[model samples]
Target: MDAQQVFALLCIGFVLAAFDKKKEHFPLPLLLLAAGILCSFVPFFSNIEVTRDLIFDWFLPALLFVAAYQFPYRDLKKDAGLISTLATIGLLLTFILLGISLYILLSPFLEVSLVACLLIAAMLTPTDPVSVVTILKQTGPQEAADIVEGESLLNDGTSIVLFTLMSTMYFESQQFSINSFLIDFLLVTFSGAAIGLIIAFLANKWMHLIKDNEYHIFLSLLLAYISFYIAESLQVSGILATVAAGLFLSRHFHVNGDKEVKERLDGFWGIIELLMICLVFLLIGIAGGQQPYISYLYYILAGFLLMIAARYIVLALIMYLIPFWRHRFHFQDYLILGWGGMKGTISLALLLGLNAGGKNSEVIFTLTFGIVFLSIFIQSLTMYPITRKLKAQEQKKKESS
Candidate 1:
């Protein structure tokens, strides 16, 4: 889109955000999306297309950094084991199962390869940190919120790595081996994280040189993009790098920096987060409205249901069957986390990046767009009620005791 179109969308997003803030009933992301769809009927909005570069290069770093910066380091340390397992092993399991399921169901009717199916799985694997984390912080248990958010912060890297690997194998005909893939994954993931930590440490120390807290915030904003850009240029996961920087900087600032500065930082990031969320959902809505995929409604529903099943199945295996996680959370906690794994702009961004070999491109796009919409629309609305019920049940149990 041109500068004028982009500015217009931001203006609209700001207005929608104001309306959502005042009304305080509907979810802001959903409202923004609906508004985008409505606005798309206008000729001016109909041709707006969100590119992959716009998301990965421009939008994602800020959104991911804000989330990581806000997350409590204490909570992360406490739930590190569960979060790691879910982000890595749980994601792998969901990807494998969902990919296999899609291949079985779709290959019969559509011109899709197994790798393409797996690519689709990779796109949908990363739980969106934006919507789920926001709602859970308000209504869900603190522990549940921590686990979900933490997993999201870590898994975006893994999911992107997976997508890149699968995309290479599909598009470039690159030979894949389990051993080499594992080695590459570890190297890329940890290297990005290490770089981010080092940058964050340096950034924190530099903060001491500046007396103004405002400069500190500006430096952090710079740090987010710098860490991300450097990592990406080095062929590693920029998402993880940005996230690591955010987390480390947050912890350092909270523990040693001025209290007023931390509050100011929080307030600054809060507005940034809101603006990004509004623009992303609004753009997705407007883009989706232009190409209504009603014909693929069945595939969309199937993919959405399969994604949910894959999530619960992984959670069940990890939370209920595994000895380590079994006692940590109640069944309701798992239910909330499982159901709250909503897909958002990231999945769509990945889909936009995919080539999908030509004929299967439409199928992949439809599935990605359709499922993400249903996930954001249905799961976002319902998660709060589910979380509220779980809290109520826990409260009742405590009262009886």
Candidate 2:
């Protein structure tokens, strides 16, 4: 679909959502996804196709930027230690466990080598910020939500680092070297951050100079794409760049501006997010239509199992090793951590980008899409109940204390 049609559908969807009582109970991602699926069945709309470039180029940066822009930087800093551990060590643990499990269990019928399995595992490691933040908005107790958001933000960088390294190794049959991996990872991450920071600084300065809300609003949208483009040109992680730029802009803009600027920017980004959310989810469903149904079913089931089992094992191991985390961790937190790690567009993009000759490429993509769907719909819908129970238990303990 063209941009105008997409925008119009988004307006209708948002308006319907605003009026629909059922939407309030379900996660917005799930609702948008359903709309996309419904659109696919329509007589003429079945032929609608979105290219990978549109999603990667037009949608991703804006979505990531808005997410980063809205992030509470101060809260993120306060929980940096916990968030870092989850994003880094926690991610590594999950990756190794999931990769090994997939290789062992699905190797027989899947016909993929160990490296290919690892590549797929790494691709599915990142959590969807769009879904997580949507869930956070529905649930109260902002503390737990902040932790999930912070982990999701930082972990995207970590997951992408692993994905790039592993994908290179798989496709090139290159041997592992810690130094080589570190060099590439650091170059991408550091360059992304450096570029994003520079752009954010310049953008903020320009906004201050203009001292006009309309100009600031338009510039903010431009800043999102500019930071991403610059990062991509530098051969860095453009998504991370957008995130960093967003957080920096959000913090500096608040400190430098009055309430009106903040309000205008808030409304502006909200509209951007609403439009992007629909487009992204629609893109996701359309992407899924390319996969054959039969082959993907088994792999999807296997992926679902591997992802969940690996998550539980990682959470248990981490909590056991870290006494502080053990003390703080609750049953519901464990459940949410495993379930809330929904895989979205990032996974879909990587899966589609997989070389066609790669072992079981079609099967792998189908499985990846299935896992992504389950992650967003099943886990996202259930997270609220898990959080509610955990919060209630915590309250009970407080009363007893």
**How much does each candidate deviate from the true structure in C-alpha RMSD?**
1.9, 2.4
Instruction: Report the lDDT tens digits of candidate 2 across residue range 33-90.
Output: 7677666666556656666567778888998888888887788778778777777788
lDDT agreement with native, every candidate: 0.84, 0.77
lDDT of 1 by residue, 68-90 (tens): 99898888998998899999999
Q: Tell how far residue 73 is off in model 2, in angstroms.
A: 1.6
Q: What's the lDDT for residue 169 in model 1?
A: 80
On a 0 to 100 scale, what is the lDDT of residue 239 in model 2?
81
* Top lDDT hit: 1
Off by over 4 Å in 1: 21-25
Model 2 stretches astray by more than 4 angstroms: 3-8, 253-257, 328-331, 395-401
Model 2: per-residue Cα lDDT at residue 249:
80
User: At residue 73, what lDDT does model 1 achieve?
Assistant: 88
